[model samples]
Target: MDILQFEKQYLRLPSAIDEIHDELFDQKGIRVFVKRDDLIHPIISGNKWRKLREYIQIAQFNGYKHLISFGGAYSNHLYALAFAAKELGLASTGIIRGDELTSQSNLYLSQMESWGMNLKFISRTNYQKKLIPKEIDTTNSMIIAEGGYGKMAIKGVSYITKEINQGNFEHIICPIGTGTTYLGLCESTNNIEVHGILTLNNLKEIESNALEVGIPIQRIYDAYIFGKYAKQPEELVNFCQLFEQKHQIKIEPIYTGRMFYGLYDLIRKDKFKPESNILALHTGGLKS
Candidate 1:
């Protein structure tokens, strides 16, 4: 199948927006809505599909038959890429960190292998350097950065703004890992406050990335990164559970959970002006 056909058949573009209710928001005269990017697809859901679609188009356009990317054992990026490549009749390779790990090391890794992805595990040092293996062939392959971070991804993510009515929202917010989604929002939106909640202590890195791309960094919150990336503390876990119970929308501690937690804190603190319409992006880390 071709890339356009695959997108039309499998992907949900312009994902739905749902309004969330809370007494605090009411008290503050603020309206909260969530962009349900998680509903885009089951496996390749959220910003993953948004970030990968452009790369896939570029690959097919240039006659590339393979997609290669770097990630960890349980990387959602790799898992989604494997499934996307399989459905689109393309080859995929996942360059994983941690040399001790194998394809069978975890369910996600094994699943990637099952989807016909070539899993190459490398040492942490080499992974940091993003070294490609000597055995793997790079011809006709598109190398995607870890977490789908790149200018192309920023372009893909900017399409989210096209899906949204910019006039209706006063502020837009999303969780920042590599800052691709955040930067994309910053690039596309005018007269909207783009807020980023750092999932990890990478404020400096995100700022550097923004500056590199000529995006002015503003309203980035660093106080909400519970401890570090993927820490999953009890407070965050409980918050995710209650959030699920309250809204019936699933969220995990790694990304969406922290974002919502931080958003709620900001709301309570009156960080936003009264009567502000805020849109929070649910970037789907549930299966990652």
Candidate 2:
């Protein structure tokens, strides 16, 4: 399947970096800009949209009756996949990672199920094993890695370089989960430095993964893990709420919020020079 063909079906989101000019510079005392990939698509927005678009196209072209993927209960990827699959007339099965379900998380899960996505819950141990269920057909059905963080996920991230070229930013920073997005940006550019503010505590593993990509990543800052992925502290939540109030841009506590927090800290520690034009890629997953 030609990924370029489906590009026309989706509306390209306009960059929203202009709106936060004052807050990013004057209020934060840092020359920060944003690559608003969050607005890429209304239904399947942000990095997930970019990563999944081609995979969905491939599945359709291969005549897949069902699309099976992996994610957690509150996975933005799973949610977006459910919506995109319904739109493309394909059946979706989401293999969720955890067992715990709060009221809010369950509500979103119910919505995805209502949208015709088959929801399957597995033991956390099994989820960590990263085993693909045998019942699902791997021939025609495309299995998108959880969080879409593999090499295949880099396709969506390659678009970031085009945006950077247009803006002429000196550096790019993004929240790091599986490192696919950061690696994509690193591969797409030469001179610009790409930083990934890791949300996970185990920096060595993520750093190793980044190195495995064989791309020049400027740095990986794991100082603000906020007690691991999806586990947020009061300060992190408060910071996210305050940022939303100030910028009116809602950021998820796990990823973007931590990156923003780290960016602020870096500025406070005199890490970023005032003259440096830094671009922060808002790889939005706030809804999840």
Candidate 3:
């Protein structure tokens, strides 16, 4: 594979939006449509592609042959980056957050290794502050932040807002991990109310980061985190299963499920009156 092929997206662009016919939304006088970004690819789909697109191009343009990044044991960002690096024929190094995960075997970690990404395990303490060990030299690497949160990421994520806004939805709903997607939507849209269902509990930090980017959490739902990040309550799991059975669209408990759960909770509270058009951004990572 060459940089030219890497420059090509190699996946379907501008995914379709499916209108969900459910009484749960209809009775609330809200019309919900799901943006199927997951269909962009079987692996590198959704916001992952949006976040990485420019980074990949920049690395290739700058003559960088490697990509380095950070993530947790079950990070979809790492998963997508590993595969994207493989597809783009670029070398990658993944600095995982926990040192304990090095001894444990999991599909996510194994797949990253399979994609030829060198996996470096680090203690959570140093990982939080210093990140990777200094022995691993990344002189020619383009480093991507965890969950793809960076300035260049805003450029990629902004495309989602530009595309979704073309349909004229009153509200945009998405699951937030690093607030990069939410920030991009805020920077790109003019009239749409971007509502983020935060997957993590760091509201103060998220708001601070957004404010640093010139937009605060205008409308965010923090009640649906289910105690902490990546925790799947029994109720949320059941709701995800039932939602898949009803809508025939699979959603994992990590991101998309939490967004749907929060959306339903808001609807129950009469968040939206009748005749409100809502668009749910399905940011994918169904592998969980």
- For candidate 2, the 10 contiguous residues with the lowest summed lDDT are 1-10
User: What are the lDDT scores of the predictions, listed in order?
Assistant: 0.92, 0.76, 0.85
**Which lDDT tens digits does candidate 3 get at residues 113-147?**
98899999999998898466888888898988888
Model 1 lDDT vs. the true structure?
0.92
Q: Residue 4: error of model 2 in Å?
A: 5.8
How does residue 121 of candidate 1 score in lDDT?
A: 94
TM-score of 1: 0.98
Give the alpha carbon lDDT tens digit for every residue of 172-265 in model 2: 8898887788788888877787778988876676668767877656788878987778898899999999988987787878889998899878
Query: Candidate 3: deviation at residue 143, Å?
Result: 1.1
TM-score per model over all chains: 0.98, 0.87, 0.94
Number of backbone-clashing residue pairs for each candidate, in the order shown: 0, 0, 0
Error of 1 at 57 (Å): 0.5
Error of 1 at 224 (Å): 1.0
TM-score for candidate 2, residues paired by index: 0.87
**Candidate closer to the true structure by lDDT (higher is better), 2 or 3:** 3
Q: Which one wins on TM-score? A: 1
